[model samples]
Target: MLFSLITMAIVGKLLHNKGYEIEKLIPFVLIAGLVAYFIPIGAIIIWPFKVLFGIIGGILGFVGGIFGSTIGGIGGITGGVVGGIGGLIGGVLSVVFGIIGVILGIIGIAIGLAFGLVGLVLGLVFLFFIPATILFVVIKVLHSETKIAPDRR
Candidate 1:
């Protein structure tokens, strides 16, 4: 459909940068064209629905990401690495454990997310205690010094 092609072209320009491959984009456009050609009315409705849900999902994902990154950016960097490594290991383990290997891959990601959250909380608690602890020690040391070396007039 003409509508699909036009919209897809607009979306491609908006969604992707100059380096984006046309080949990869072709499938998306083709799918959109097919959906438009078959369900023209539905296409109009889908846009608003997609935009609404996308905004909601994007906001929630952003907040969750901040929480995860608070610890050591585990959610941002380590999370991807762990997921990739887990998938690779799981693939290998599949030869021996079958479906359990796939489950392990999912579990690996869950563990990484859990570790990041716990570390973030623990790190915050430690930070709070650190300055207070240092100040207490400094005050104690100064107090002890005054007694040890009395300034007699």
Candidate 2:
């Protein structure tokens, strides 16, 4: 599953760098990942190389991004090389960050749920006492005319 996700991300990035819209390809990638999951033999075969190649790919991609950015400054082939490497790095980082975000989101939900009743009670108090009272005061102030004492200069 990890291998497939990583591979799909890499492929998606590569294609995106080539100017293909990744959104359109997401379904296909998902389908491919599903197909890959069903095939255990392939996963077993790629497991050993997955880590080794991922590191190598990342190192090479970093070098390529630097090189491409330098060349990209001049225009032309820069887009292809630089974009691909940038996309490669971006894809991997996105997946990593996405996972982290999900984890944090889960933890956040648990925390929020734990304190939910407290929050609701506090919110009701504020709503009824603070904002509602403030709004009433504001409306009264706005609508009521102030009586000024006659000037007795």
Candidate 3:
């Protein structure tokens, strides 16, 4: 556990320095570590729950980081307000759709690509696009503010 935490911290810092944000990685890493630690301590019955929780935490962390970055990039109160509203909507949609799809899969109402499709949609909408949008927006804002053109070299 200690080693995991230390590793997470170091990796988090490295990612941050490489243009990734802490908010996006910390929750997922912590949840993953906790799940790993608990599997050895708990019985098999608890593993599934731990895994599910870890997934949920990762999703939430990803969305939250995107929302934060979006708000941070806009550079004013109006941007913050808009970002907050958008984040709230996005978060709700992501959670609802993700849970529904997972439930459907477990209940056998969905199969194969059908199950994966929902998950993929949920992931793309909440996980990938949100973070990429925020990162792009932030980089552009920073570039504009510093008057330093993005390096091509």
- Best candidate, TM-score: 2
| C-alpha lDDT of all candidate models, in order | 0.79, 0.83, 0.79
Which 10 consecutive residues of model 2 have the lowest summed lDDT?
A: 34-43
Query: Candidate 3 on 1-153: residue-level lDDT in tens?
Result: 765566567667776788877678778667766765665544466889989999999999999999998887766778789889999999999999999988988777557778789889998889989999999999898778567557856
Model 1 residue 52 CA deviation in Å: 78
Q: In model 3, what lDDT does residue 6 have?
A: 61
Candidate 2 regions exceeding 4 Å error are 1-75, 117-153
What local lDDT score does residue 33 receive in model 2, on the 0 to 100 scale?
Answer: 72
Q: What residue pairs clash in candidate 1, if any at all?
A: none
- Give the TM-score of each candidate: 0.25, 0.28, 0.23
Clashing pairs in 3: none
Query: Which of the predicted structures, 1 or 2, would earn the higher lDDT when compared with the native?
Result: 2
Candidate 1 lDDT, 1-153, residue by residue in tens = 677677677667755676568877777767766766777755677999999999999999999888866866755688889899999998788767867777898999899999999999889879988888989998999878456647667
Model 3: ten consecutive residues of lowest lDDT: 36-45
lDDT of 2 by residue, 6-106 (tens): 66777677777788786777876787677666767566888889989999999999999999987877686667788999999999999999999999999
Q: Give the TM-score of candidate 1.
A: 0.25
